[model samples]
Target: MTGLFADDSEQIDRRTSRWIRDAVGERLQQCLRPESRLPTHLEQLMSELKKRDPEDDSH
Candidate 1:
């Protein structure tokens, strides 16, 4: 029946969503650990951005 198929589809969607949430949570936890460091390129970019800019107001 269509109802049975819909129920199965909903269950599958829920399981998939839960799995994705768990995976992302684990990855975020890993990233939040003390040992994590910003990538070199991003660090360089941030350093450049921190330099004085005449047009910037938040100095």
Candidate 2:
């Protein structure tokens, strides 16, 4: 059914997002030296992510 498919698709998308965010965050932590600016960078990234429209699809 369409409903079932949609539900699964949404779940997959959420999991994928979590995986990507976690992977990027882990790598950022490992590669970003000057620990002082890490928080600022992370805050900016999160703020931008929150501002972006999920349905826009225009990167």
Candidate with maximal lDDT: 2
Best by TM-score: 2
Steric collisions counted per model: 0, 0
lDDT of each residue in 1-59, candidate 1, tens digit only:
35656655445454465466458647766877668766788667645644633333444
TM-score of 1: 0.36
In angstroms, the error of model 1 at 2 is 29
Instruction: Go through the candidates in order and give the C-alpha RMSD of each one to the true structure.
Output: 14.5, 10.2
Where model 2 places Cα greater than 4 Å from the true spot, the runs are 1-12, 39-42, 47-59
The alpha-carbon deviation from the true structure for residue 14 of candidate 1, after best TM-score superposition, in angstroms, is 0.1
Question: Cα miss at 7, model 2 (Å)?
Answer: 19
Task: Tell me how many residue pairs clash in candidate 1.
Answer: 0
